[model samples]
Target: MDWNKAADNAQTLMQAHEALSRLMPRPDAPQQTWLAYYRRSAAVYTRVAEIDRGHFHETMFWATREREKAEAMEQSALA
Candidate 1:
């Protein structure tokens, strides 16, 4: 196996999660900000899915869930 690549993926995943947490919204952020956050989250998970490729569906599932959240947020913003 490609140990170096695996290590790199692990590190990247950690950094991505940390960055996501740092970007977490405060209580009063505007809808546009929330929408952007959700979209960024979806993109993150999508990259994770790509990085984890074929190990299982978990990453893709998370990606799908994130995208759903983004969609819901967008719908709410339009309402």
Candidate 2:
């Protein structure tokens, strides 16, 4: 497996997560709404990280899949 490619993709996912995190609602927004939004976003990042960590001793197929899942989660949150 190409370790460098996996690293690059992992970095990309991390960056996307950071970008999404920065888009959080303002501080004055309803507490429940803000918490719910961030909770879902955090779950995606946590799942992606879990998959990437598992790939340390195996293959790296799930990174992309998790990234797609993250994107879908973000889109669903937006909707």
Candidate 3:
């Protein structure tokens, strides 16, 4: 497992999360933007979960404790 690759992926995921968060509705905005942002955020979160699962499985093959940590991170992200 390449730590660099994992770090890069984490950065990308965080950026997506930030972008989606900014799209949140404002009092003066239309309802459609709010709905769109919600859907987009959901999709981003799903992608993050998938990435996390993959990372967890890959790391688990080498270290059980690392796997557990990864799984916890994935669960926290979902929650």
C-alpha lDDT of all candidate models, in order: 0.64, 0.48, 0.45
Candidate 3 per-residue lDDT, tens place, 1-79, comes to 1113333244244544455445545756654444444444454444555565645443333233334444554566679
Return the lDDT, model 2, position 49. 61
The superposed Cα distance between candidate 1 and the true structure at residue 74, in angstroms, equals 1.6
Candidate 3 deviant stretches above 4 angstroms: 1-13, 54-79
- Measured against the true structure, the TM-scores of the candidates, in listed sequence, are 0.67, 0.40, 0.41
Cα-based lDDT at residue 54, candidate 1? 59
lDDT winner, 1 or 3? 1
Which is the leading candidate under TM-score? 1
Better of 1 and 2 by lDDT: 1
lDDT of 2 by residue, 19-54 (tens): 554655677876455555555445445555655564
Q: Local error of candidate 1 at 62, Å?
A: 2.1
lDDT per residue as tens, model 1, 11-48: 24555566676666786988777777777666776777
